[model samples]
Target: MKYILFIIITLTAIFSFSQDKEKEALLAAKKANNYVYEGNNLINEDDFVSAEKEYRKAISEQGTTVAGIYNLGNSYIKKGSYEEALYRLDQAAKIATSKVEKHKAYHNIGNVLMENKKCKEAVEAYKNALRNDPSDEETRYNLGLAKICAEQQKDKEDDKKDDKDKDKKDDKKDQEKKEGDDKKDQDQKDKGDQDKKEGDDKKDDKGKPKDEKNDKGKGDEKEKQQPPQPRPGQMSPQQVKSLLEAMNNQEQKVQEKVNAEKQKGYKIKTEKDW
Candidate 1:
C-alpha cells in the first residue's frame, strides 16, 4: 500500500513538471517583434485601423507584453474607443517590465480617463505616471492640467445643481400664483353673476322686461294728449263750483265742533266703519 501511494505522488509531480515545461515552451514560441514593427509602420502612415489589427495580432502572439498591449491601447485611442484603450493600457501597466513602459502605460491611461471626462481619476493616473518616471515633464504638466480640470468639473456640476434648484422653485411659485389668479378670477365672475341676477329681480319687481325700458320711453310723447271732457247738459262748471262751496261750509262747522270738544280735555279719536 505504501508503494502505491509513493507511485501516485511521483506521477503527480511528473505531471505538474511536464505542464510547466509545456507552458514555458508556449510562451517562448510566441514571437511578437515582427508584428509590433509592422504595426508601428502602419501607425506612422496614419492607418490606425490596420495598425489596430496588427497590434491585436501581436498581443495574441506575445501573450500579453507591455509593448503589444501599449501599442494596441494607442491604436484604440486613435479609434476613439476610450473604454477599450483604458482596459489595454491598464493591462500594460500591470505587466510592464520596466519603469519607462509603466510610465507610458499610466500616461496613456490618464489620456483615456481625461477623454472619458473622469478628471479626478485622470489626475491620479498622471500622478502615477510621474512617479514611475520623474523625468517626464509632459506627464507632470498633464497632472497639473488634470487637477485644474477636476476643480472646473466640480464647479460646473455645482452650478448645474444650483440652476436646477432655482428652476424648480420658480416653477413652484408660478404654479401657486396661477392658482391664486384663477381663484380670484372665479370669485369675480361669481360676484358679477350675482349682481346681474339682482338687477334682473329689480327689473321684474318694477314690472318691466329687459328690452321694454327704451320701448316704453319712446311712447311718452304720444300719451300727453288730454282725455275728452263731457258734453253740455251732462254737468255744468257753475253747478260743480256751488257744490264745492257747500261742502266747504259743512267741513268748517264739523272742524269747529271737534276743536271745542278737544278744549274740554277730550281724546277725540276718529273711527272708520268700512
Candidate 2:
C-alpha cells in the first residue's frame, strides 16, 4: 500500500508541472517583454505612432499589466489623444496593486483631463492621486493649476452672459427707437393730410363756382376792419351843412352880378303878370 501511494504522488506532481508549462507557454512572457522594450525605446525617440503600436501589442500579449497600460496611456497623451489616454489610465488605476502605480495612473488621468479642458474633473483626479501618495509635490501643484483654470473658465462664462444681456438691451432700445421714428413720421403725414383737407374745403371746384354769399361775408369782415362809407341817400351831418353853405355863396354872387348890370343901364322895364 505504501509503494502504490508513492507512485500516485509522483504522477500528480508530473501532471502539475505539465499544466504549469502549458500556462507559461500560453502567457508568452518573453514576447510581451520584447514588445514592451521596443515600445519604451520608440517613446524615447518621440516616435509616438510606432510606440503606440508596440504598446498595444504588449497589452494584447500580456493582458493589461500596469506598466504596459500606463505607458500606453502616456503614449496616447503625447499624441493628444485625450479620450483614449483617459480610458487607458483609468484601466491602469483599476488594475494597479500598489499605491505607487495607483498614484501614477491617477496623475496621468488628471493630465489627460486637463488637456481636454476639463479642469474640474482634472482637479478631482489630482486629488485622488494625492490621496494615494501624499508626498507627491507634482500632483499638488497640478491641483492648484486646475483650480485656477476652473475659476478662469467661470469668469469667462460670466463675461459672455453679460455681453449677451447687453446685446439684448441694445436690440430692445433700437426697436423702441425705430418705433418712435415711425410714429413721428406718421404724425407728420397725418398733419399734412389734415391741412390738405382744410385747404380743399376752403377752395372752389372746376364745376362749382365760389358762393357770392361767402364773398359778401368776406367783404363784411373787411368792412369791420375799415371806417364806414356813406350810402347813396345818406350823409354825415358835417358834410350836409358844408354843401348848403356852398350853394348860398353861389346865389349871392349871381345876385350881385345882376344888380351891377341894372345900375349901368340906369333904366328899368316891368312886365305885367300873366
Candidate 3:
C-alpha cells in the first residue's frame, strides 16, 4: 500500500512540472521584448490603430507598471480616444505606492482634464497634485486660473439674482404707490361729494317759505308789522309796582265816593213791608 501511494505522488509531481514548463515556454514566446518590438514597429510604420491595440494588450498582460499604463494612455490619445486614455491614466494615478508617484498621477490628470475643456475638474486634479507635492508652482498657477473661472461664473449668477430682486422690489413699490394714489383719489372724491351735498342743502334753505324765515330774516319788518307793544325794558318792574299802588289808591277813593253819593241820595219812607 505504501508503494501505491509513492507511485501516486510521483505522478502528481511530474504533472505539476510539465504544467510549469508549458507556462514558461508560452511566456518565452510572447516575451516582454516581443511587446516592445511590436510597439516600436507600430511607431515606425505610424500604425497607431494596430499600435494602440498591441500596447493595450501588452499592458494588460504585464504586471501593473506606470510606464506600461502611461504608454498605453499615450497610444489611446494618439488614436483620438480621449476617454480611453483618461480611463487608463486614472488607473495609473491610484497605483502610487510613493508620494512622488501619487503627485505625478494627479498632475497628469490635471492636463487630461484641461484638454477636455473641464477646467473645474482640472483644478481639482491640480489641487490634489499640489497636496501630494506642494512645491509644484505649475499646479498652483493652474489652480488659480480655475478659481478665476469659477469666481466669474459665480459673480454672473449673483448679478442676475440681484437684478431679479431689484425688479421685484421695484414692482412692489410701484404697486404700493398705486394703492396710495388710489386711496388719495377716493378721499378727494368723498370730499367733493360732501361739498356737493352741502351746496344742495344751501339751495333747499334758499327755497324755504319766506314767512317762516322772516322771523329770523328781517328785524325791521317784524317791528313794523307788529303793534307798538311795550318791551320788557320799557315796562320796568319798579314802574309797574308803582302803577299798581296808584291803581289801588284810586279804587279806594272810588268806593268811598260811591258810598257818600249813596248816602246823599237816600229817601225815608214809612212801610210795613220790606
Candidate 4:
C-alpha cells in the first residue's frame, strides 16, 4: 500500500512538471549562468524578437533578480516598448540587493523615461542613480546633457505653438477687418444712392426734369465752391446773357401757368405773378 501511494504521488508530480515543462527547461539554463549572456548576445546582434523571447524566458526562470529584470527591461527598450521598459526597470530597482544593481535599474529607468520624454521624471530617476553611486561620472554627465536637450526641445515646441496661435489670431482679425470695411463701404454707397433718390423725389414734386435739376445743382455747387465775385458789375457778358435768358424763360413759364389755371376754370387773384 505504501509503494502504491508513492507511485501515485510521483505520477501527479510528473504531470504537474510536464504542464510547465518549457518554463522548467528555461529555468535549468538560467541556473547555468549563461542565459543572461546569451540573451545579451542576441540583443547585440539586433535580433530583437529573439532577444525579447530569450530575456522573457530568463526573467521567468530567475524571478525578479535585478540583473534578469534589468536585462529584460533593456530587451523591451530595444523593441521600443518604453512603457514596458519603465515597469520592468521599476521591478529591478525594488529587487536590487546591491548598489551596482540598484544604480543600473535607476539608470535604465531614467533612460526609458527620457526616451518617452517624461523629462522631469527621468531627471529624478537619474538623480536617484547618482545618489546610489556618485562615482559614475558618465551617468551624471549624461543626465545633465539629457536635461539640457529636453528643456531646449520643449522651449522650441512651445515657441512654435505660440507663433502658430498668434498667426491664427492675426489672420482672424484681418478677415474681420476686411468684412467690416466691405460692410461699411456698402452702407456708404447705399446711403449715397438713397440721398440721390430723395433729391430726385423733391425734383419730381417740383416738376423739374432730371437733366435740368442735375445741371442746376452742379452749377449751384460750383458757384458755392468758387471764390466770391468782385461785384455784380464784374459778371462776364456770357454770364449776364445766360442770366437774362433764364429770366425770360421764367416769365414765359409764369404766363403759361396762368393760362392753364384759367383753362381749368380758376380765375387769377393777381396779374403780377403772370
Best by TM-score: 2
**Is candidate 2 or 3 superior in TM-score?**
2
Q: For residues 1-274, what per-residue lDDT tens digits would candidate 1 score against the true structure? A: 9999999999999999999988975764455766788899999999998888878787777776678889988988988988899989999999988899999999999988998889999999998998889999999998988999999999999999999999999999999999999999999999999998887875755667566666677676456565446587666677789999999999999899999999999987788678
TM-score of each: 0.61, 0.62, 0.44, 0.54
lDDT of 4 by residue, 1-274 (tens): 9999999999999988887997776666566246677778888999878876777776666675566678878888988898888888899898888988889899888888887877778888989999899999877986997788779878989999999999999999999999999999999999999999888776655677457767899999999998776675588767889999999999999899999999999988874664
Q: Where is model 4 poorest over a 10-residue stretch in terms of lDDT?
A: 26-35
Alpha-carbon runs more than 4 Å astray in model 1? 1-29, 95-100, 200-274
* Global Cα lDDT for candidate 1: 0.87
TM-score between candidate 4 and the true structure: 0.54
CA lDDT, every prediction?
0.87, 0.89, 0.77, 0.83
Instruction: Give the per-residue lDDT digits (tens) of candidate 3, residues 137-233.
Output: 9888888887777677678889999999999999999999999999999999999999987766655456643463665668778778986766866
**Which is the winner by lDDT between candidate 1 and candidate 2?**
2
Winner on lDDT (1 vs 3): 1
Ordered list by lDDT, greatest first: 2, 1, 4, 3
Q: Tell me model 2's lDDT, rounded to 2 decimals.
A: 0.89
For candidate 1, give the lDDT of residue 204. 57
User: In terms of lDDT, which candidate is strongest?
Assistant: 2
Q: What is the lDDT of residue 211 in candidate 4?
A: 77
Q: After superposition, how far is residue 4 of candidate 3 from its true place, in Å?
A: 16
lDDT for position 66 in model 1: 70
